[model samples]
Target: MLNTQIKYIDYISKVNDEIEKTNLPDKVIEKFQLKETIEAIEKVELLVPVIGAFSAGKSSLLNSFLGDKKLPEKITPETALATELRYSEDEHIEAVGANSDITTFSIDDIEEIKDRAKDFKYLRMYLKNENIKNIEPLILVDMPGFESPLDLHNQAIMEYINRGVHYIVLSSVEDGTITKSMRRQLENIQAYERGFSFFLSKTNLKPKEEVEEIKQQVQDQLEDYFDITNEIGLVDDNGGESLQRVLSKIDPEQLIKTIFLEDLKDNYFSIKEAINTSISASGKTKEENNRAIQQLQKALDETLQKKNNLIEETKSRYSDIRINAIVEAVSMDLSNSIEEIVSVGMSGDSNALSETILEIAKSSLIVNVKDSMNDISGEIVNDFSTGLSNLNSVMADFTISENWIAGIAETTKKMITGASNKLNTIVSERKKVQNNNEDIDKTYKAVTSVLAITTEVVNPIVEVAIVFLPEILSFVFAAIQENKQKEKIRTTILTTTIPSLKRNLRAKLPEMFNAQVNELISQIGEQFEEAIENKQASIENAQKEREEENRNMEQIIQTYKKADKAITTLANNTLYKE
Candidate 1:
């Protein structure tokens, strides 16, 4: 029943009130980055990516929504890419490159854009049209049809499904029903647990009676295919209903669950875990408390030692594995492009050769090194998972690493009495559904933030390879003879250029990888430290109360109980349920 993102903001505000109950200086709110999470929730926009089969008028439908032939395409763009239409007073297109480079294009540079389409990651077109402004947070992604060529286009679609709250899929009315290709796309959407609407475009090209029959047949097929009885929103381009109007009908609670829910639940569980730890530590005698504190201190000490070892291991991994992979990939790819490299080498354009080598290095890094970093990230989590076992049950286990697996396991034993009871009521239904549907792709807080920063591991490593090019390849072009030049050029590249690239990479890359790995582990380990400190704070606070004979332990315990009850009731509401 919650119809706006305001419900989520209000929910967070209420949770903050509970977080304030404990007198710990560093609260659960700061540990989980809830303030930033709320801001991201407020700025959440529903991306409606429209996909369909060839000539399904996917682009036409979106440009029509603009009420102008704004997006230039032959119904669908020729390339396997997306053109994202967003609202901005200052209108322009930013061509995002695979290497995260941006090139700005004029709003009217349609031909120029088409010429350079293959070079772009996606085109982010900012528009100031009235209808676009009216939709507010709903941005439309114009996607390629089912039969589009190239792997990057498919990758783009796959990435979009992760962030898209829902999809608006279209097929032509003339086709009369869904095609096999479209059915596959819908299956994929279902696999990702995303909801989509069906729109039959170009209805004006068919008879009204025939359009009605096709719409009905498509609706029935979708229900039968997806094995669900929920009615899909079907619209036509001939004007009976508008796409914007149907998009407005999207259930806001579903949107919240899809976009902001994982982050919200993260903070919820984090606070619950902290409270439980405090309660568990409450009844311990002074000697028991000292023993526990000593144990905690021992773990913290072990963490510092582990961090130094991990940093050293990260440096070795990059030098041994990541750098070697790049060297081999760049060398192997260039070996095949001997003729092209020879051309650039003979033309005396050291800059062209540098550019060619840089492209190959970038490709190699994206395909190879990025994944290796994720593996290292997984190792970091697994290494610390055991050491921080007491505090991680609710928070650390689920901390974001692309390759790590998160499971609730037996860590629920850490919860205190009342919080455990409340968790039981929600876990049987709500948690299971959310984990199955939405939490599969989630990355928790600073872990993900650090990863985002480290994803640029490619640029510094590969771009650094460029500087060595001019220095190393400068000698090959000094003397050119037609008879021996080609072989000399190839040998020089395979011998001199590549080794220089590898040497410089090995020299500079381990440090880069170390910094990233350190930041990631530290970000995760800092949370562990805070949780330990909060528990210690709770134990000490209770001691002070007993010494003064003024503080009521039952009252403090009741505050936590009340917080658990409120959180449980909120989870039981319609927004958190399936």
Candidate 2:
């Protein structure tokens, strides 16, 4: 997997270098970058960094993994640094800096030692656990709160992530969804490294129902935005209650293990299959058999080009029919909605009148827009279907004469084999004379013998093949002529029809709507904007209400944070206890 990632990285780097020279599209470059990142992650061993907003129970989740309450103080109770846990027999914890300076500290003294100068840039503690020993070696790095007020603290965590294996994103239920800053950090990590997971921490802090709702919402949002289909794990401090619910949905440890093992197995099998196929194909002599293959490849390319031209021609012919249908549908819907709105406004009902008027206008605009879109979609589908049908018809005419080609290929093979055998026989007959370094006359005779056989055996076969060449040449010319005619028809239709249809559809709709439709559209636009502004005001009011709710929720956040800190502190103290 690592090898594959390295190859992918190198390939992408070379491609990017070329793209820079060529000034390729930004979207193409971005696509390459995304592919490179995903490939890189597939190779590296990832350490899931459980990160979140300050006091979001990131430490508590780490404690749960360790199966101990003794981790380290979270938030202000402990130095704002990342602490990683891995299996080790040694009783000491090692703190290493980005500068490569190492500091040894008793885990118990971590909280008491307030010397910021001596504080390590990164900390790793070895815990004596049978479970850790049995699983693939992984160190869980507990990141400081991503949104920590202290820049140095955040920078320290960021540095740790740059050097670390993978990330496990964490968030709290009461804290709302993961913040935008946290997401940006994750994106930054993804830019360089591939390994990361998301964890909704402190599920126990909220009710099961609320936690589930938050989890679904967060998962849906992440999947929609990041295109990640993996189940997002949720962590709870209380005996893994909510964590287990998430675990039931997705086992993080199992997933991590599978990431490497399954990928390695898949790559190994693929390489093996490729090697076997190459060896099997190589048995056929290139000199004897490749000419026919080349001819077939060339024929296929020509056929494809012809098919493409036919497809384009058909698309041009049918495109307008589909676009007109959709445009008519949209115009009708918009006109009806506008008429209804005008009728309602004429009635002069003022109570809820403003809301109703705005709603009607917005609805009319949406219907009209959707109808236009529908027409475009219908045109696209019709074009695609017509194109495919025409391509099939062209392909049908370009019949691949496999049997005739195969016979010629086999004849060429026989000629090469016969010549080779005659040469071998002559070489064998001259061996004794050549070995003695004597009998110059015999050696000359042997050389002449092989040359004569080659001229006689190979030349006649070539001559025979050459005789048939005129027929093949005639056919190739005929095919080229047919292809040219097809191209001319294709170009004529596309140039004359498709663009005109699009323009016509665009023009017909406004005419169909007339002056009343125009007035209604203008009214709808104004009402829709007014509705949006009203919605924004309502949302602001809701936000105020949410802030009040958060005041009540702050206690829960604090409770979870305290519980997390207590558990981590206990675990750290226990592990380092003399």
Candidate 3:
């Protein structure tokens, strides 16, 4: 069975070799490589590199797994350098330098290494212990934390991680929040062919309840912030055991077999077989070849159409999500502004009145300022979905077009290439323009200045209103006095005067006491107008971009149809000639 598997692998490998030599599409090459990698996993043992932030217990975890504190200079021991554990007949740790120079050292010698020896990028150590030797085909490498304060340490760690097949991400229990940088790193890793395991290290530092709480919080954060739903493991050294005990709890052998080995082997063999079949049947009779090509093209078109539809749907969903987020943010700001205005006005402290009014106006004006700016995020998602849908639809239609299915495939390849180039250009230009628009800073400064002025205008009025409370009362009394007959004066004063007094106090007090309030409102309105103007400009630019994209897509479609027609015409003419 092993021999047969090897023969099958070899045959697939040869087919891939031919495909690579030919100028096949990148997608085809990627699919071929994906298959080969899976097949190779069955024969070769996979090595995974474990990495994390500082104080994340990467070394401790490794030590626990090895059942010995032998992984030289474990993470917290002295931050000496990064260490790699591999299987070899001889047991020794060696530092390898830039020019492939290697120097042998004992675990204790790590402290003595200073300049050039310390400068070594990667440390390779062989396990001499009997227990470690029993574990087949897997090596655990402990790397320096990527976020180490030491620049050299970080650089060396990243270099090693770049070459790793799998990553074990260690995080702290106290602060389970992944920083933006860490999130980016994880996202990049996710894009590649690697398995990721998140470990909340040093669980013993906190109580069981606290640890569980932190885990839940981290899990929620990962889901909300990164959309990662994977189960995360929490390991603590303080759980009545040393590192060895903790390591024993985790079955590295099972982790390797289940996560990496089996699935990869299966995928590799399947891909290898597919590639071999495609290449072997590459050259057949013209009619037979054309028929196969047509089928493939039809399949491609249909796939493209399906993908396009999915993209459109996703775009719509994401657009809604984005718009809702914006609307909620703006609404909250507006509510807060109104609340602040009310609070400050009612405080009855004249001196602080202007400052409060100004703050309210400023807050209210800035709420929708960002909305005015042309945000292409929504449109980009929409267009991306549309483009995908169009491609898929074209592919689906082409699948049934026996006359020019092959030509449709060629046309799609060209269209995708062109679209990719155009997308890159558009993105680059948009970024440049946005970077150049330092007007946001200027607008912010202007708004701040206007808010200050608005406060200055309102403060005095608020103070006067508060101080002349009796005079304001007299004015209401006078108005009520004018409306009443002598007999009804007491009744009028009791029933109508107090209510009118309250009403006038509520209405006229804001205007009379907070005179600067109106000025502040005007300033806020101006700022809002400015923001709207800026956003309008952005909207115009976005609309222009959208129109251009639509035109380009239309042209591409027309070109494709023309090519299809020409191919059909030729095919028909050739049939008649034959």
Candidate 4:
């Protein structure tokens, strides 16, 4: 196996050296991601990403794993950027910036790193610790906790996906068996084929039976959603037996071989094929070239079909999550708004009630919907960025545009306008009641106006609610006629007002809010679909160009076939030995 690794590495190095010597068109070489593949093969470190919700003991677990308090542990969102712990002969921490510049600094510089977190893309802390020596080739990546900005967290994790980084997903039994945020992250990870192990951290905070229950729950949930090969375990901050369990579960040597072996084999075959194609250099008869092109065309069609399906699946998953999250938030906000309006109606000041309803609708309700829209938009942008990053190495001229952001912003404004218009209609109707004329008739008119709208928009059950409201108002009027005390009259009105208002709102508002939220969802879906359609066109064009390039290299294809068979045989032998 060692001989196989050496031979494979040597062959890949020779192929790259040959490519450089030939000095082929850079554009042609890049189309196959040959350069990136070479770099991936040359790198020795295996990235083990530690991810979880904020304050889920990721840093503590790492500190325990290293047998050193190297990472700052404050139970806060520490290590703002993605911080990495790698094996080094000499211990030190350095910050890597966006422009590929590195800064070596002392422990005191952590404050500055915190202050300028956004500026640094990653922090690499190299250490020579005895505890981590056995896992020398493994780089433990502690991500910015999921409690960070959704975009930031998604961005960090998506980079891991593009680079094929496996994960050490952490969750606390104390927080819950699983949370909505953790589920979302896990779903995103599951989109790609990779290895991951879950650790239920902070188990000392729970009883043994409870920990067992949590572990069972996690296994059930993950098995339903993911093909998790590595089993889940319980770990505490002290990290003793649990720590050993985690270490054994994610043994660095086995992990490296499992993740990289297949990937290395794939890239190895691809690079070898590229080399063979270059060596033959366009020397084939027209008939032979036509036959090869036909084969290429068929493969391209199947690849494109699978790519489209994957893209559609990703988009659908994202949209469902976005809609559900937005709708839930809007429903809660609208329910609260209705409750606030009902509470204010008890005062019997129609003017104050109207003002309160409008305040809640325009402020809290609108803000909730807008925030949801923004979150969905951010997610779309992140997805686009992720897709484009994967493509950029192969398609240098391809670029992603943020032009849809403005359009989404405009659509959200229109949705908010629709909501405001609905609220404004109610407020305007309230203004027309004549308080100066016969007071009881005027009050009755106002009550009936509200009831009319509610019953008209919702259901007939409100009729029972409306019946009670008129009688309550009539009793208040009678109290006034008898020259009853102001306090007594006010109390009498409230006792009836509160229950009537609640009955009307419970019967009416949920349906109305849900309809509005659904409408907004439809609008957002249209925008997302449009974005996806544009991306599909781009993928088709890229695939066509790739096919055309292959068609012109029929002789090269023949050579690649021979080279591929040799590598496949060697790869099988290595796998058999393992």
The lDDT, on a scale of 0 to 1, for candidate 1 is: 0.61
| Clash pairs (backbone) in predicted model 1 | none
Off by over 4 Å in 1: 1-3, 14-21, 27-29, 75-80, 230-240, 261-266, 279-283, 294-578
Model 4: how far is 438 from its true place, Å? 89
In terms of lDDT, the best-performing candidate is 1
- The clash count of every prediction, one per candidate, is 0, 14, 18, 0
What would the TM-scores of all predictions be?
A: 0.57, 0.36, 0.39, 0.47
Q: On residues 1-578, what C-alpha lDDT tens digit does candidate 4 reach at each position?
A: 23433544565555555555532344434433433334444444566788887788888888888887878777344346778887778777798876668988775566777777666667888778765666545567878787654334434654454333467888999876676457656754543334677889888898999889888888888877665645787787686456545655555456445534554553444344344433332343444434444433443354345434434454354444544453355334435455444444555554344333322322332333345444544443344334333333332222222242343334333333221121223322444443334552221111111112222222222223234445435555555556655655556445654444444544544445344333334434433333233333333333343456435344444444555566556556554456
Off by over 4 Å in 3: 1-45, 72-79, 113-117, 130-135, 147-151, 191-193, 238-578
Pick the TM-score winner: 1
lDDT of 2 by residue, 307-394 (tens): 3443444334433453455445533433444434233333443222222222222223333333343333333333323323332322
Model 1 over residues 221-284: C-alpha lDDT tens digits? 9888987554545455632246877777876556656555654665566566666655555555
Residue 145's lDDT within candidate 3 is 62
lDDT of 3: 0.44
lDDT of each: 0.61, 0.42, 0.44, 0.51
